[model samples]
Target: MEIYIVGGAVRDRLLNLPVKDRDWVVVGATPEQMLAEGYRPVGKDFPVFLHPDTHEEYALARTERKVGKGYHGFTFHTSPEVTLEEDLARRDLTVNAIAEASDGSLIDPYDGQADLKAGMLRHVGEAFVEDPVRILRLARFAARFDFAVAPETMTLMRRMVDEGEADALVAERVWQELAKGLMESKPSRMLLVLRECGALARILPEVDALFGVPQRADYHPEIDCGDHTLRVLDYAASQGQPLTVRFAALGHDLGKARTPRDILPRHIGHEIRGIEPLSELCRRLRVPSDCRDLAHITLVHHTKVHQAFELRPATVLKLFKECDALRRPDRFRLMLDACLADARGRLHFEEAPYPQKAYLESLLAAAAQVDAGAVAAACDDKSSIPAAIDAARTDAIVNAREYWQRDN
Candidate 1:
């Protein structure tokens, strides 16, 4: 049997990137032969085995036939006669189709090396349309490598989207790709690529609707809601924020898309109006609770957080209670980070200071020092304990705000 290292390991290595995982493709090998050689079979839809020692995956050389629709529609054919070239041909991108033989010989049947050097993303073959997930994967690769998509490949992606392949993608896979893309260095590229191919409208219409929507240029400077969202997402990524924070940045301004035309560029009450669409997005994708919660809090309270200095001490204390900042400070900090990303994500405002985040943090810290347990103990009646705690926190916030103002 002939074995070769394939896919991302080869691609990343060629780019001088740190290879995280290595995938293997074994040509001229049957499942029975693989088992006899001590490789454990792990694939359900095809012949994939794991090495007994390294535990890395080794999939047999195979070809796929598109039977129905979406990613799961493909049927696999694996045989000892299957060539390494045939297996490589079934891959999504040309850059990813390169293979390295056991003896360190490189194989580039589709001219993947040329495209890799040119920093281009191009399809390997016509089989690219057989799987809809390729569209998401290509967009994600654009975000990762900052590579330009070949025009013909983009045309092919648009055709696939037009043929309803994008709609056939499953919820889990959509969320998976989107989450991965959000964590990439230039997540804005992923969104813009999906938009260019019209897959963004199919998969995330709420986000797509924001593209042409107008926003007040005095505040946004970008003048487009979609542009603002992209900036926010990229800012979150550039700050090395976690997935939850990045997700929140992406969803924070979704309500702006639903603004009434009579209001023109103003998105007043968009934060509250954003709840329905954002909730639907999270529910449809079956998004993880932490991501969903952080996004929700950022969407609903971001404007309030930005207006922190204008809010009364009691109002600030109430906001803290609603956000549960004292109990779940990490998530609260993530929400603030998302708000900070939004603040910095406008035209010529990339480095703008977000004093509100620090102000809120200071207020939260001061209120948290109020000793709720002691306040509850001192309350004369059980019914008044909640009020007593709130009063103490409000007073603490008042003092802290005055101190902060004086210091600033």
Candidate 2:
């Protein structure tokens, strides 16, 4: 049997990127042969094994045929006769279909290396339309590598959407790709690509609705809610923010889509109006609580964050309490990061200062330092203890704000 490195390992190596994991295609090998050679079987749907020494994945050479719909609707054929070229042909992108032999010889039957050198994302074959998940994967690769999608591949992706293949994708798989794309260096490209292919409306309708929705031109010179959201996502990525923060940035302005047209570009209550759609998005995707909570907080309280200097000390204290910033400082910081991204993601505002972040952070710190136990102990009546602690925290924030104003 001849083993060859394949897929991401080969793709990343050719691009001068770090190979985090390696996958192997064992040509001319059976499961029985792999087992006898000490490889541990792990794949439930196909023949995949783990190396006894390196523990890296080693999948047997196999080919797939589309049977029904979505990603799971596939039949796999694996045998000792399956060639490495056959296995490579099943990959989604031409750049990912190339393989390398044990002797360092390059195999490029589909001209994947040429496409990679041209920074192009082209499909491997007509079989690319069989799997709906490839649409998301291609969009993600566009974001990750900043590569241009080939016209033919994009036309095929659009055809997939028109033919309802894109709609057949499962929610979990959609979220998986979305989360990975959000953490890329320029996630807006992913969203734009999906929109171009009509998959955004199918998978993320709330976000898609923002594309043509108008925003106040004076505040958002971009004048498009969807465009603003993409800018916020890119800004979050530029800050090296984590997945939660980036997700929050993506969902932060969803409410603007529901704005009343008579109001024109003004969305007076969009902050509160956004909660329903954001919650729906999180629930539908089965998003994790941490990401859901941060997105919720950013959507609901971002206006407060932007108007931090205008709010009263008591209101600021309430903001801290509502966000539970004392108990979860890291999430609070992420919330601030999301708000900062939103504030500066508009046209001509990329470098705008967001003093509100530091102000609120200082206020939270001061409020957290207030000794609740001491205040409760000093209260005259037992029923007044909670009120006394609240007053003390507010007073601490007041003092912190005064100090900030004085220093400035």
Off-target runs (Cα >4 Å) in candidate 1 are: none
RMSD of 1: 0.9
Alpha-carbon deviation at 131 in model 1, angstroms: 0.3
Candidate 2's residue-wise lDDT over 212-326, tens digit each? 9998899999999999999999999999999999999999999999999999699999989899999999999999898999999999999999999999988987888889998
For candidate 2, give the lDDT: 0.94
> What's the lDDT for all of these models?
0.94, 0.94
On the 0 to 100 scale, the lDDT of residue 348 in model 2 is 98
Give residue 318's error in model 2 in angstroms: 1.3
Q: Candidate 1: minimum summed lDDT over ten consecutive residues — where?
A: 371-380
Q: Residue 406's C-alpha lDDT in candidate 2?
A: 100
